[model samples]
Structures are given as structure tokens and as C-alpha cells.
Target chain A: MTYCLGIQTHQGLVMASDSRTNAGMDQVNVCRKMHLYIHEGERVFIILASGGLSITQSVTTLLRRDFDQGRGLASAPTFYDAARVVGEQIRRVGEMDREALKRDKISFNINVLLGGQIAGEKPHLYLIYPQGNPIQATEDSPYLQIGESKYGRPILDRGVRYRLTTLEEAVKFALISLDSTMRSNVTVGPPIDVVVYQNNDLRVRRYRRFTSKDPDLQRIQFQWEHSLRKAVLELPDVDFDEGAEQVI
Target chain B: MTYCLGIQTHQGLVMASDSRTNAGMDQVNVCRKMHLYIHEGERVFIILASGGLSITQSVTTLLRRDFDQGRGLASAPTFYDAARVVGEQIRRVGEMDREALKRDKISFNINVLLGGQIAGEKPHLYLIYPQGNPIQATEDSPYLQIGESKYGRPILDRGVRYRLTTLEEAVKFALISLDSTMRSNVTVGPPIDVVVYQNNDLRVRRYRRFTSKDPDLQRIQFQWEHSLRKAVLELPDVDFDEGAEQVI
Candidate 1:
């Protein structure tokens, strides 16, 4: 299983993904799920994928090769077109493999988070489904997440306000979300990769990857844990004297 | 859908469950998923259920009707036997319904959390499966949860240490966990039912139910949200000046 998410804050976009993949408990492996395509000042696209490795890998491979022969991510006219380009590749993979794999009862699955900047447009985020359909993140939700999303969703729901959060704060929330996920689930683990792109920067900046032992990751996780326990402890103590009959 | 859990703390055990149940989006309704049977001074058991309402409702109905014909939950000799009784009822329900449901492509599904005290035995918690098997929560984990468990699980992982926490603290954690689940998933909602059982009490005591509009429920949810955001605000800031190349 995989856990990856993208936050489209007003200041910019922040993306995070875990590095664990498995066919079963006995066959576990680490694979980088964050991919970046940069045409420098022209355009940039980040794809964070989760699902069957075969399907995601095939779609990304097709996306990487598109630059030489046809319209590629870097050449797409806008972020929307680039997202569609990704959706189309997912469809291409599903067409080629879904039926053959169905013969063995394996379902073709791939979910992609596509976010980045194009020179003339504001940065945007889209979640592409296994069915090759795409949905853009709106200001109301202000974030897109795929794979193992629920465990981390409440914090995003409560803390991420696109218009009020800064690029740096957005990055912080992304890591915190990932941290909550990793604590509750073993299917997701670090070496987590994060990317922060300021709205008009038009270039990738503030990229960092942390292994489980990384100091910054450790400090952030420890601080968050302490704060969480303190928060729980600080809650008003239950009044057993109320006799538990008080419905209010 | 539902989210119900039992925590075996040093002081006693804490049980909580949301009240929403649905066969489909259009078929949603409010149902009490928590059941209590008391032999008063001899034995007591609380059953929190999730999954097919037909299966769970059937199991509870049989257990409730047992006093007139067979041995009832109040008659179980130990907490362990009470758990087996719940599991056996589940298997009995499966025998009666599984094949008929299969004709309609619906599989028998229900998960139950049983927690209470039986005379001389220490308080205990058990999770019963559709296959009539049961697992006891141990000193190590000290908690059991069913359906929509993940989003609320991290808090239990962090705040609950059975040997270390007071029953009041455990109760606080359970409500906070339910709050997290309700915020992230629409399948689970209030009015939630909670019960606290102290070891060797051998009585059905301390039961409370909270509707969405319940003032105490609102206070807990609001306090949790405020503390959570404050905790996030108190975390150390990220230094983007470290540049994009850090990998550790």
C-alpha cells in the first residue's frame, strides 16, 4: 500500500509520499514514489503515485518517454493539459494491462497526484484515478490525496486553509499528515520526500527527503508527539462524580 | 458503517460506538449499536457492533432472548466465555443467513467488541469475527476496534497504555478517537454511546449516549479541535533556507 498527498495552499503547493511497496507481507520493498519532470523555467510537474507498482511504473515510463516523440508533460500548454496527459497515460496502461491481468484476477490500479507550475498559470493540483479520470483540488478542499488518505485527512481538514497558510506552513502540515499516517499504519514508512513550490517561483525549491533516523524528521515527529500527548492531557478530566447519567 | 472500540485500561475498560448504520446511501438510519446484559453483582457484558445490521442485530437479539430458553450473557462464567458466546452467536447467525445472503451476492459480515467483568475474572476485551473466532486484547495493545477503525487508531496508539492510564483518561481518549473518525468519514456519526466498566464491579453502570447536538459532546469535539490546531501551531518552523538538496 502507499500514502501520498498534495496540498494546494494559496502561497503554493506541498506534496509528500511514503516509500514502501508490497505484494504481500512476505514481499516488501522500498521504491521512490515521487517523480519530478522539470523543463526548468518553461514548466515543471510532480507526480506522486500509489497502487500496483506495475501499473504506476508503466504509466510513468510512458510519461517520461513522451518528451522525445510527442507532447510531453513539459510541453503541455497548461497544468490542466499536463494533468490530462497523465490521465491519458493511465488509460493507455489500463487498456494494455487491465484485461490480461483480469484473467488472473488481478485488478489494474493506479492513482496519481499531479501538481506543478507552468509559466503563465497559477500552480494547481489534480488527482488522477485508476479509471483515468481527473479531479482538480478546489479552494474549498485545497488538497488532493491518494492512497492511505483517511488516517491523515482530519488534520488536513482542520489545519489547511489555502488562503491563510504560508508555503512553509503548508510544507509543515504535509509532513505532519504523513507522520500521523506512519504512526498508525505500517504499510506507509519513511524515507519520505517533500516538495514545496511557491506560486510564482516557476521552479522547484525546498525539496528534502528524510530517512526514519533523519534529525529534522525525528525532531518534528517528537515535537508533534509531545504536543499531542499534552493536548490530550490538557483536556478537562472526566467527572465520574457526574455519575455518567448526565447525557448532556 | 460504524466505528466502535474497547480499551482495557488499568483502572477498567472503556467502550464507545457511533450510531450511524446504512445498507446504502439512501437507506441510512439511526440504530443503537451498543448492547448491555447484566446479571448484576455476577456478570456484565457490553457489545459494540459494526458491519451488516442484520447479522449484528440478529446476534444481539439471540443473546438478549437467551435468558428464557438458554444460558444468557449474564450467565457466562467468565469474560472469556462471554466473548465465546458472542462469537458462537455470530457463527449461528452465519449458518442461518450466509447462504441466503450469498444468493444475493451479499456475504455475512459483522465485527463485534465485547468488554466487561465476570465475577472473579479481571476486566477483559475481545473482538469477534464473522467466522466465530475471537481474539483478546493483550497487555501490549490493550485495545480492540471494529470498522472505520484506522482514522481513530493513532490516538489510541499514542494516548492509551493500559497499565498506565486511568479509566477517566481512557474515556477521554475514546471520545477523542471517535471525534477524529467522525470528522474524516461520513459513514460514522453521532449519537455515540459510551460505557465505562471498572474491574470486578460486576454491574452495568456508567453508560451515556451523546447526540450530535449534545453539549458535552460538542465541548469535547471543540476542545479537541482547538488543542489540535494549537499543537500544530506550536511546532518548530521549517527552514526553507536549507535549500532543496537536503537528503538524510
Candidate 2:
């Protein structure tokens, strides 16, 4: 289980993911889910993976191998082309592992949020399905999330708008969404990785990892709870007016 | 597909449920999920049901039949007995229909959140599983929700506390939770039925229905969205300080 999110804003893009991996309750481990590929001033691609740990790891390992052999994504001309190469690599990994996993009653599940920019392309975001197909985020639906997504969706539905948000605001909302997901779901634990890509820069601009003890994360949670309680109080209270006809 | 919740608070209990039922997209219809049986000063029992429509309807209809025949729930000594009867009734329905449904590849799946009070007894709440087993809500976890629950859960995790909340506050939180669930999920829809049982009253004290066209329902959702956006703005913005050290 995991939680990963990607958002495209007017000013840039933001991606966030938790690091916990669990095959079962007794076998929990921490592994980085956010992988970065950067070519300095030329291009950058950030992949946030979720689902089977072994499958995602295999896909990432093969991707790295592709870069090592200079045969795939490294030379793709645009973000769209890079997404295709990533999709192809995911299928390659699935082809190699799916039959073995099926024999064990295990699934070859994997989902990836691939986003970043090429030198001449706009920053783009794509959600690649386990079947190796992908869908790009558009202005109408400017964000995508994978794994344990519902617990955090209400906040995004109410707070985010691609045309209205600045890069900084997107980061704030992404962190808050991740915070809500982490609190409600045990599978998505700490050591959250966040990256911000400034539009037109064609490179990664900011990245940080927050652990359980991070003061800033704690403060965010505290302030959110405090203001939420206060805000709830400001909402109109129910009056219980319907019982006049049948009061006991 | 449905969403229903019951909350226990210091002042009383609040239950809210959406009223959508669908066999498929084209078959969507309005059907209340909240059921009430009030015996004036003697007792009151509320049931919020979710899952397979046929199964829930059968269980509910059978319970009504039992009460009509004076063979169950209505003559039970306490809320616990009534809950047991409800569970027994669910299992009875499954016994009668499970095999016939299995022929069509249909599952005998359902869940129920039951809560209320009997005279001389404290308020009680139970979650009855499809297999007819039941678990009561305790002080440590004072709420129970069935079906499409996750989208609305984070707010409850951050807001509701049974030890301190007034009945009015519980109603507000339940409405907010329902609103969030409805926004994120299409399977759960309006006309919502809400009931409030004030502790020691031994009967329901409030009841109301809100449809999609209901002005009050819209007002609640509008104010919630407004307050939530304002709350997000009040939180401190994320500073992109990590990038100076790791720029690519």
C-alpha cells in the first residue's frame, strides 16, 4: 500500500509520495517511491510509483538500465514520448514477471505518475495504469493520484484549481492532502518526498524528504487540526427542529 | 453503492445516510437507506444499511415482518437483544437467498450500522457484518460508517471526539462527512435522511431529508467549501528552501 500524488498548476508542477512498503502487516519496510531523472538545463522527469513493491522496483531498475545503455527515455524528444517509453518499459517488466507472480496468486500491479518537462515542452503529467496505458492530466482535471487516493480527494476537490494555483500553493495543498492520507491510512507512513518543478525551467527546482519527527510537518498537522476545529464551530449548528410533532 | 454514518457524542447520537441506489448507471434511483423504529418513550432503533440492494432490502423487510408478528426486535428487552435479532434477521435473509443468488454470480453482501436506545438502558451502537456478526462502538471509537466511507473519514478523524462534542456539533460533522462523500463519489447521491437521538429521550428527537434541490443542503456544502478554502489559506505556505542545495 502507498499514496502518491501529482499536480500541475499555472506556475509549475508538484509531486509527493510516502515511503512505506508492506507485503503484509508483519513485513513492513521503508523504500523511496519517488525517482528522479534530470538532465540539468535540458529536461527532467519525476516518477512516483505505487502498488507491488517488487514490480515497481523492477520497472525502475529496468528504466535505470535503459539510461545506462542509452536506449530509452534519455533520448525521447518530448514529455509525451518519454511517457511512451516509460509505458513500454512497464510492459517489459510485466512480461518478465507476470507469469511467475500469477503462479503464486500474486498480482503484477503497478501505477506510476510520470510528470516533468522537456526542453521545449510544457510541464506535463500522466497517470500510467498497471496495464501499461496512460492518461495525461488536462486543465479540466489538473491532478492525478495513485493508491489510497480517496481519503485525500475531498480536499483536492475543494481546494485545487489548475488555473488558479501558483506553484507554492500547489505544494501546500499537496502536502496537506498527503497529511490527511497519512493520518487516516496506516499503509502510507512517513518520510514523505516532495518535488517542485518550475514551469519553463525544464529542470527540477526543489526537493525535500520529511520524516516522522520533522517539525514543519508536525506544525502543519497541528495548525490544520486547530483551524479545522475552529472553522467547524463557525458553521451553523443543527437545531433539532423536527421533533415537535412526535416528541417522546 | 451508498454512504451512511452514525456518530455518538456527549449529547446524543447523529446518523446520516445518502439515498442513492443503482443496479447500473442507467438504473440509478432514489431509495432511502436510513430506517427508523421509534416506540415513543419505550425505545428507538435506527438502522443505516449499505451494500447489495436486494440483501439489505430483504433483511429490512424481514425485520419489519418480525416486528409486525411480535416475534422479534419490538419485544426485545434491550438494545443488545434488538441488535442480535437484527443480525439474526440478516443471516436469515442470507440463508434464504444466498444459494439462489450464487447461481447468478451475485454475492450475499451487506453491512449495517445500528444504533439507538431502550428504556432503562444507555444508548448503544452496533455494526452488523454480512455474516451476521456484530461489534459495538465504544468510547474510543464512537462512530460507524458503511459503504463509500473513506472519502469522508479524514474529516471525522480530524474533527469529531465523542467525549467533548455536543449533539449539534455531531450533526454538523455528519453532514460535512456526507457532503464530502457525495462530492467525491457519484454512486452516493442525494436525498439524504438524517436522524438525531438525544440521550435519555428513549426516542428520535430530530429527522430531516435533503434532496439535491434542497436549499439547506446546498447551503451546507457551499459554506463547507468556503470555510475549507479559507482554512487552507490560513495555513503557512511551503517555502522552497530545499532547492538551493539540490537544484538540478
Error of 1 at B109 (Å): 1.0
How do the predictions measure up, each by TM-score?
0.95, 0.97
Question: Across residues B99-199, which tens digit of lDDT does each residue of candidate 2 receive?
Answer: 99999998888999998898998998899999888999888888999999999999889888989988878888888899899999999999888888899
Clashing pairs in 1: none
Candidate 2 stretches greater than 4 Å from native:
A244-248, B242-248
Separately for all candidates shown, the number of backbone clashes (residues 3 or more apart, or on different chains) is 0, 0
Task: Flag regions of model 1 displaced more than 4 Å.
Answer: A68-70, A240-248, B68-70, B240-248
The lDDT per prediction is 0.84, 0.86
Q: A162, model 2: CA deviation in Å? A: 0.8
Alpha carbon deviation, residue B194, candidate 2 (Å): 0.6
For residues B1-248, write the lDDT of model 1, one tens digit per residue: 89999999788888999999887888888888888776678777788888899888898889889944648576777777788888889999999999999999997989999888877788888999989899999999899999999889878888789788888888888998998898889989898888888888877568888789978778877888888877777778776534444432
Highest TM-score scorer = 2
Question: Under CAPRI classification, how is model 1 graded?
Answer: medium
